[model samples]
Target: MTKQRSDEPEVKPFKGPAGGWGSVRSLADILPREHLGPEAYRELARQNKPDGFMCVSCAWPKPADHHPAEFCEEGAKATAWELTRLRTTPEFFAEHTLAELRGWKDYDLEQHGRLTHPMRYDPGTDKYVAVSWDEAFDEIGRELKRLDPKSVVFYSSGRTSLEASYMYGLMARMFGNQNLPDSSNMCHESTSVGLKAALGVPVGTTQLKDFKETDAIFFFGQNVGSNAPRMLHDLRDCRKRGVEIVTFNPLKERGLERFTDPQNPVEMATLKETAISTQYHQLRAGSDIAAIIGICKFLIDWDDLAKADDDLPVLDHDFIAQHTKGFDEFAAAIRKTEWADIERETGLAREELEASARIYAKAKAVMAIYGMGITQHVKGVESVRMIVNLLLLRGNVGKPGAGPTPVRGHSNVQGQRTVGITEKTELVPVEKLEAQYGFKAPREKGLDTVETCRGVIDGSVRAVVGLGGNFLRAVPETGAMEEAWPRLDVSVQIATKLNRNHLFAGRVTYLLPCLGRIEQDVQASGPQAVSTEDSTSCIHGSRGKAKPASPYLLSEPAIVAGIAKRILDDNPKVDWDGWVADYSTIRDAIEDTYPAIFKDYNKRLFTPGGVWKGNKASERIWETPSKRAEFLTPGEISATGFKDADGRYRLITLRSNDQFNTTIYGYHDRFRGIKGTRDVLLMHETDIAAAGLAEGQIVALESDAGDGVQRRRDGMIVTPYDIPRGCLGAYYPEANVLIPVEHHAEKSHVPAAKSVPVRIRP
Candidate 1:
């Protein structure tokens, strides 16, 4: 394995749906190498039974009653990983050099097999050699003890279980450091930052059940079917009830238009697809600010018309006067924005905007759902505020079926943030440490993912212990982070399989094999149940079924507990053994730490689903200074790089049907007719012709905002699409090459993945 790209043959266009059996056919080539056999596979599938274990793939809510084929296509791939027959033995690692492994494709790494045991890189041989778990722990402990607390950064992925995340945070705090930058730091940090500023909370306000009561759903920058297929069921249910679903995106995705659920037998057998969107608008990326402003302006105008004619209620005047502030400023700002500017930026006509506003005015309840598309802009935080402003204008925050929902990406990404996986200013994590372990936590807000990479490049940060995730590829400015890795003193990855980041090991690197979500987790006490927080802030348990692939596959919590005990100074109060032995104690500790939030964790979690928090606090009670939801007007519209560039396209990063976030299950993006390729851009035919480019022609995309950054991903096939004029879209991680690391929102450190300025050349 040298640093060569995957040499698989160019893929043919997607023919049809890869049904359960058809999907298995697609994996035929790799099945011999990756399949764990029928016995293991069946057990793995059984383990995915509703009561057995949660789906290791996406965070889509499961049905209360078990459905036989409940898992999605991507979920099956994740299950396959758990039940894979291949194993990464010490001998195999000894045969391949680190440099050689660097050439492997992203999929090939996972295809290699489950890592069997702990391994340390042997600089002499340029390959990894077997290392005893005890030895590896001792080595990491020694390296951590030597580095200054400030020079080390601990990173976690969304895959980490809640208990593991809490332990990781506790371990870092005990080591007198709060330099914790996690996966959430990259994706939904803007949601947290924006929602917290407007609604006094950082998480989504609505749950899945809320959709059942929704009268109207304003979906912004989200592809419901592709990103979250389970949501299609809810949307389909709503559609059946005559609920309106208005979709806004840069491109017209087929999944958004019609979705045939694999779980529904009637639809699956008849090959019938459910209609999803009632009104689909091709919103230009980066111009979301304009779209939101237009909605606000329409609301204001409706109010004025209502007042003059004595017709009806346009703005919720009663709600506004009783429960809000700063309306005059918001109203004045709305008045200042002209319809011409809104139409120009949003690429929507005045009539369409008016029609949408009319619907909003007439709706008794409205729910707005958004994803990375809305949060990955230079003015992303402001765009989020606009959504809040719209909701606040109608008293949508604490209602039954209405509120802002930022559809989260990862399984436990939201949980990780809630468990204190953050780089806070006061380093209050240390204060918690002192209260629990009798040690003062550091008093510095550490660098986030982007800042940590900068620190590594500048030599301020010398080491990183990533609990999980592909850091190099996931971070913006991949070239910089790749170069910076070699400069670090130590780098460690506690993971299940090899990823792109594992190959970019530093001077002192170690890959500690850990258990997957579906593998059996045996602790000193016995089998343990790991807790996870859903997108709705509901906590539940996940238990593994299949036997560990190897005796060495330790659970995440066990791995973290082992490292915590070995690295930190021994404290009687810090009972690492007790915590690892019984996860209930961890829950107990969590309850103690956030009693008002996690009261009766044990009793409540025992129920079939789980319990909800903030119910009492949500009823017309704001945590803000005034104890009421505030209407903060961003008086002036924030300008983005898109406005100044006349003909340049605003590129948005998207995940293919076969992918999830940064993880590429395979190259085939089935729904879009793309297969075995990441080197392609989706664009409007008009935009292509306007740029003097032809379909199927390869072109380089130059970014004016990327500050001369070069995208090595050349020769990308172009496909004529119904995207908005001057708007472009491409797969992320590859598109990460074009987005500069420094390009970020002012308030939130989230890199702009939605609104990027670029020009195409043939």
Candidate 2:
């Protein structure tokens, strides 16, 4: 919405590796700008500590032996940003009208600082006026009572803790709606769908310790440096142990190229960086399925040739026969796949796939790591299953340092799902919940993020209660949401900072400020500590040391309890007041619901470095219908059948170095050499030539989703870069407008943000 003040962004080649002094300088710059004092730095140091708060940035597991300063650059930025000395009070809202605030940039809105009090939208004045918490809750309760429970959508952000998410899910179900759409639906739903179908579990099989023993690692479409910087330390150690790291992505990511551990004094002082990836392959966008299938076909051919000579075959026949099903069909499918088709689909040579396969076959233990790049596609579920299939081929699932790992984005996103944040009632199981909590849970399947948006647009959804995320900005079809959100009967946002979503107020809107991760949450009994589960399934306690940003700010659990108490009124089955007083009761309830995984959840939560909830696949135990690991045969390599015209390109939405999800930290993307702008599109030189466009030329991107809907985003400057020939990259939230809401993954229903077909217009 805001035009660039300058002509174009300053783009230069960045030669240094990721992290090192660059990260150090970033942390220093953020602290001063955010006005974070020495106390804030001390609080940041407590991140990932045994009795400290969890970093709100990424979900990379905390190491057992962590340094005094275990946080990353992005973690430090998030800390300083959340604990900033600025505040947005009633006076600030009074000065800026809702109409005026709409013109401000996302970064500008967040920079105004934390929301200090409960505020309600005044449509008459077009300004938000401070309201009492009780009044806000009463109004929300009144609206919920008037509307049918099925008509209300409850959305949760990934940053919410397990206790809060559990309470939120329970409240929604008790209110008779399972319309619980979370941030995971937009990112890792594919992982859940594919992994469940293949490995009998939705989570990864390996832990953080497996990285040290891994012989080789295949990174498919994951940008670890900008996202999970803490993972760089593990990768560096793996490299030191002679582990081969292969990366496949559309663009050459600096994190995969090289990394300098900021914690290592020698490397920081000498400006030396560790070479991370042993091999980097620039595959075409949406070609992951094809390239992975190529690897499988190569391995199959190698095994066939070796078996013909009566020599030891490359296939792990003993493990396959003993622990898996459908391998014969899977192998047959791979054998029929042609190399010519693989090359055409992947934009890679036959030699490249074979070379990578050779490394993979030779490695005794392997781990495959991926992110949204692998999961945010039309065939994302199939792509994830292919990764699992590759691992299963070599008996990697039950072995040390071997398995599939889907690197999650949000800090507690995985934990949120583990604690019962889902649209499907079967995940929570109404019978078990009713037995444990004495309340009847909703049995019907509910709407996901995309469906929720559609429900809002169709007037079926009347009220929306957001726990912590900027849903309007994060989801696809931003323009459509901007139009539909105002039509809702009621909307409530329980957040720490002001985001664009707060501006998308319904007829009656309320903003309830909540405590940040670093703030002290004093309950009725005493100060409370919430728990978060990382990507590795390690459950740890996070106790905030800093004071609340504002006196009026309530803890997330308290906010959820307050709303639930008002809506449920004298319901004896739900003990909202008791759980809010002490979080351990909530943990006990979680243990009662999922006794197998969370056994002794309270006692183990206080243990040093927390406890690991064992994964079934890692122990050679599958819970599938066949009672064994299933080798799913994908129907075709090019399952999406997304064909780009001669001049069109496949555009993938990505976060910048200075941002996380929809929260903009700044306009610069240091890793990609972008500065002072989020309106530029990173394109290949050949693509620019074919499109008859030059670098710095402003253009519009029109979606070719083929659903007969015209979706376009204009005022984006094209920057020729090292991306693949037919692929383009742009910052998210800004580029989300080009992604059609209906164009989503099949089983998971996650929007195909990373594989949208688009045509450039000058």
The window of 10 residues in a row where model 1 has the poorest summed lDDT is 1-10
Residue by residue across 1-762, what tens digits does model 2's lDDT show?
122233347898877789988888788777887877788978987988887888898988777788879899888889998999988899999999888989888898898889999999999999999999999989988888899999999999999999999999988888998899998999999999999989888999888889878999999989998899889988998999899999999888889989998888899889998999998999988899889899999999889999998988898999999999999999999899888989988899989998999999999999999999998999999999999999999998989999999999999999988888999866776788888767777788988999998998889999999999999999998888889999999999999988999997899999999999888889888989899999988898888989888999989998999889878757676688899999999999899888998998888775665688888889989989998899989887853548757766788898888998898888668888888788888898987887778888988999887788888889998898998888889889889889888888988999999888888876
**Candidate 1 lDDT tens digits, 190-215:** 88888776777777788777888888
Q: How many residue pairs clash in each candidate?
A: 2, 0
Record all residue pairs in model 2 with backbone atoms less than 3 Å apart, i.e. clashing.
none
Q: What is the lDDT of residue 43 in candidate 2?
A: 94
| Candidate 2 wrong stretches, greater than 4 Å | 1-8, 639-641
Q: If scored against the real structure, what TM-score would every candidate get? A: 0.94, 0.98
